[model samples]
Target chain A: MLIVGGGVVGASIAYGLAEEGAKIGILDAEDSDFSASRGNFGMISISNKGFNNLAYFRLSYASSRLWPEFASTLREQTGIDPAFDLKGKVYISVGDREFAAHAEKVAEYARRVGAEYQHDILNRADLRQMLGNVRLGERVTGGSFSPLDGIAEPLKLYSGLLNAIQRHGGSILRDHRVGRIQHQRGIFTVEGPWGSLSAPRLVIAAGLGTPDLASQVGISVKVRPQRGQMMVTERVEQSFPYPVSGLLRQNPEGTIMIGVSTEEVGYDDRTTVSVLRSLAMKAIERLPDLGSVQITRCWAALRPRTEDGYPVYQESHERPGAFVITCHSGITLAALHKRLLPQWILGGRKDALLEPFGLGRLQSASAA
Target chain B: MRPPHDLPEPPHQVSFRFGDEEIEAWEGETVATALLASGVMITGVRAMSGRSRGPYCLIGVCHECLVEIDGLANQRACITTVRQNMKVCRQTRLRPLTGEDETREQ
Candidate 1:
């Protein structure tokens, strides 16, 4: 198996396949590639996902459930803790209107998914109890809390996955920006700046580079670069009990990750003052204590999102052995990509879980 | 004309003004090094949060050593050369002072 892109998604898939005794070779792009895996919000969150698509919600929920075991396995195998914390995730609402909307959304999602979905629409008092010492601003009315949603240190997770892959006899070729991919007679030939390699099966997990590589294999992957700008504060005393999605959350290291503005700026991953200021202001508004924290660094990353903002996991019909997997929620979906995706890729079993995420949905939506 | 190691040691004693307080410094050293040597930490305070920050990564990588030098804002102290009678102050923010603000300061 040959996997293009040695990011978290590709690394996860490669590690899983290698564990299954498949001869795996991963070709990673240069450091210049727009790597969402390195710059994600690192939330294994299922709080505000799958608003329209139930399959996405289910996938995220399942992945969040699997993360603890997956994190432990990686730690046991590679002695690197991914820092997977599933304590809970809180989504704060600033005003009464926002709180009502959040409550409604939580109610609707619970009604739709029923027993599978679990969350609590906390009022101001409940939120105060849950948050403990962490003070919420005066404007914060209420929030929604989900026990399943959590976070992991993404860089550590990626490193552990890579280490596991290498330990399991998988070869990783770094600085290999795959330029051309050719498929003929069930054999896939991938050409990069460094060299070419032939494999019976090929997986394109190249993030923003997915569209181009997928097209070579006749797969119409409608993935575009959606840039998200984020800011990091200097290390402070840890306050928040769990990760908060909407405004800000302190990592275990005491540094808070404040994010994020979604801009369809087309591969322009440069932080702007306006977006960063707004993020800082909003963070301060949510947590008044953060007003005394210094922003150490700010960065922007291009997330590979499909047209409808769902993942695109599709096997090329034109070329049977080629698969393209792309998503914005790479961190949230790492467990799924690691454990289940390899089965679908190697066994050729089109699991129903992956049904809603295929290219057919895009075609149908476009046709309609 | 000589190698850096063979070069004569510059004056060991130098003085600079850190805010209103006059502090002793070493010649031919960066402002950050001089400040650390003088036990003067918290080089600057952030604009947004008003949080105090000190020099991190003494090599000029992290921008944590931002300070005001000779009435100029947003100077990187880690890279800036310290000279005799150089006036240094903790930078409150990244925003540059306007003409009116500069005049008021003067």
Candidate 2:
């Protein structure tokens, strides 16, 4: 088996497939590639997902639930801890109106999800009590906590998966971005400026690079780049009870990770001062104590967002064994991809959860 | 270890209080320099690991010299100019916040 794009998504699938005794080779891009897997907030969030699409929500929730075992398994295999923390996460609001809107949105999500949805609308006092050491801004009204939401150290998780892949006897080819792909007689040949490799089966899990390669194998992956800017503050003592959603969280190392903005700036991943300043302003407004904290660094990354903001999982009808899988929430869905995707790729029974994410839906919607 | 450079004495000196001890500093020298000159090398303990820390970069870049000055926390000693009778304390990590800071004594 040959997998293209050695980001978390590809590395995860390769690790999973290798565990099933398949000889695997993963083609990763250069170190400087704008890989979202390396730049995401590492949020294992289930709240506020699938508001318009129920299937996506279920997929995320299932993956979030599968994280504990996935983290432990990776640790056991590679002896590297991914630092998966599932305590809970919250989304803070700085005003009465914002709090009302946030509360209503959480309520709406609960209504849409029916049972299995758990969250709490914490008032300002409750939020203060929860964040014991930290002081909230005066205008900070309240926030919502979702028990299933959490975080993991993204770099550690990625490294652990890569280590596990190697431990399972999978070969990793770094700096081998495939420039061309040819399929003939049930064999797929991938060629690049660096070298060439062929396998009977192929999976393209590249983030923004999926479309070009997917098209060659008879799959038209419709993905665009969505830029998100983030900031990191100086290392400080962990004060929050748990991660406060994706907007704010202190990593295990003590540095506070703050982010992010959604912008349609094509493939540019440059941090803007305006965006950084606004993020800092918002952060200070929500947690006034952070106003004095020095910002250590800031960066931007591109999310491989599909047209409908949902993941695309499909095999090429033209090329029988070729597959394309891409998603924005690579960290959140990595567990599912590792636990479930390999089986389907190896001709095992397809999970019904994957039904709604196929390319057919996109084609039908466009056709209609 | 690199040998220390010799320097001429400053024209004037100032005094400041660093945790119950009054230390002498040259008029133009920063707090970190004064602390080092007075043989007070270990300025504070790291918040996370409780490791003893002192002035790393005397240019106010490393943030290793952060000490509490006059009840204000996270003041960089490398950049702070010493004044007479200024009260400075080791900037301990959040004690009231976590309440489990085992490194407070360090």
Candidate 3:
């Protein structure tokens, strides 16, 4: 199997395929390439995902459930802890209006996902109790906590995945961005400046670089870059009971990781002062003590999102052996991609759960 | 080469407290250099790993010279100038997660 792109998505799938005794060669881009896998918040976040699509919700939930075993397996294999912790996560609401909206969203999720959807809508007092260690700002009305949500160290997870892949006999070709992709005579060949690598089967898991390569294999992937800016504060002894969604969470090392603004600014991944200021202001509004903490570092990364902001997992119809897998939630779905994707790729049963994620939906929706 | 008489005079000495002991340093020297000059190596221990860490880059980039200045935590000792009677404490261990008594689980 030849996998293009060595980001988490490709790495996770390649790790899975290699563990199954399949010969895998992953073509990773140069260090300068824009990679969301390296710049994500590493939230195994289940809540507020797949609100429109139940399949996505179920898939996310299942993957979050599988994180414990996945993290442990990687730790056992490589002696590197991904720092996966499932202390749960929360989405804080500042004003009464936001709180009401959050409550409504939680209620809808409960209705749609049924009994297994574990979420607790907390009032202002309840939220204060949950975050007993940290001081909440004045406008902190309430929030929702879902035990299904968690966090992992993204860089460590990426390192662990790549290490596990090598440990399981998978070969990774770094600094080989695919310039030309070709399918001919029942084989796929990926050409680059370094050289060319060919295989009987190919998986295009390249992140923002997927669309062009996927098109060569007759797969239409409309992936675009959505910029997310983040910052980490100076190391502090403060800790949180749960990672607040899109706000902040104190790492085990004592630095508080705060993030994430969604912007549709083409492919530019540079951090801006405006976004950083707004993010800092928002964070301080939620946790007033953060006002005193110095921001250590700030960065921006582009997430490759489909038009409707959902994952696209589909094999090429023109080229039967070619598959294109792309998603923004690579961290959350790494477990599923590792555990379940290889089965279908190896000509086994295609799980019904993945059916909705195919390009067929986009095709039919466009037709309509 | 310039003559020794042309060389500028060294700055006068200033003293600071590093924990219980008093350390003297050149007036313009940083807290990290002052501590190192006073033979107080292993300035602090990493909170997570408990590994001994001191000023590595001495340019305030590595953050290994983090120490408490006055009442503030995580001060960059390499950048802070040594002041008279300034109290510097090696960050031995992380403070409790919440407050004085309670600690949060990882």
Per model, how many backbone clashes are there?
0, 1, 0
Q: Order of all candidates by DockQ, from best down to worst?
A: 3, 2, 1
Worst 10 residues of 1 chain B by lDDT: B95-104
Write the residue-wise lDDT of candidate 2 on A128-168 in tens digits. Answer: 88887788888998997788787899999999999999999
**Candidate 1 segments exceeding 4 Å error:** A364-368, B1-24, B27-57, B60-106
Say which candidate scores most in lDDT.
Answer: 3
- Deviation in angstroms for A296 in model 2? 0.7
Model 3: share of true interface contacts reproduced: 0.40
Q: Report the C-alpha lDDT of model 3 over A1-368, residue by residue, as the tens digit.
A: 89999999999999889999999999998998888986789899888788888999988988988889999999999998999998898878999999999899899989999998899999888888888768888999999888888899999999999999999989998888889988789988889999998898999998999888987888776889999999987787756767898778888888888889999999899999999999999988988777667788899999999978888888877888888899989999999899989988887556887888888878532121
Q: For each candidate, report its DockQ versus the true two-chain complex.
A: 0.07, 0.14, 0.32
lDDT of 1 by residue, A1-368 (tens): 89998988899889889988899999997888888876788888786788788888998888888898899999999999999988888888999999998899899988888787889888888888887876789999999789878878988998999999999999999898889998788899999778899999999999888888988888876778888899887555566787777556677645789986898889788999999999988887777766666577899988888888898888887888898898888888888888888889999876678788888877632221
**lDDT of each residue in B1-106, candidate 1, tens digit only:** 1114545755566789998888876667788888887788999987657889899987767778888887776567988887899899998755321222333244
Which segments of candidate 2 are over 4 A away from where they belong?
Answer: A364-368, B1-106
- Superposed by TM-score, candidate 2 places the C-alpha of residue A319 at a distance from the truth, in angstroms, of 0.7
Residue lDDT tens for model 3, B1-106: 1123344874677898999999988777789888887888878899889899898898878889888777566778889988999999988776443332211111
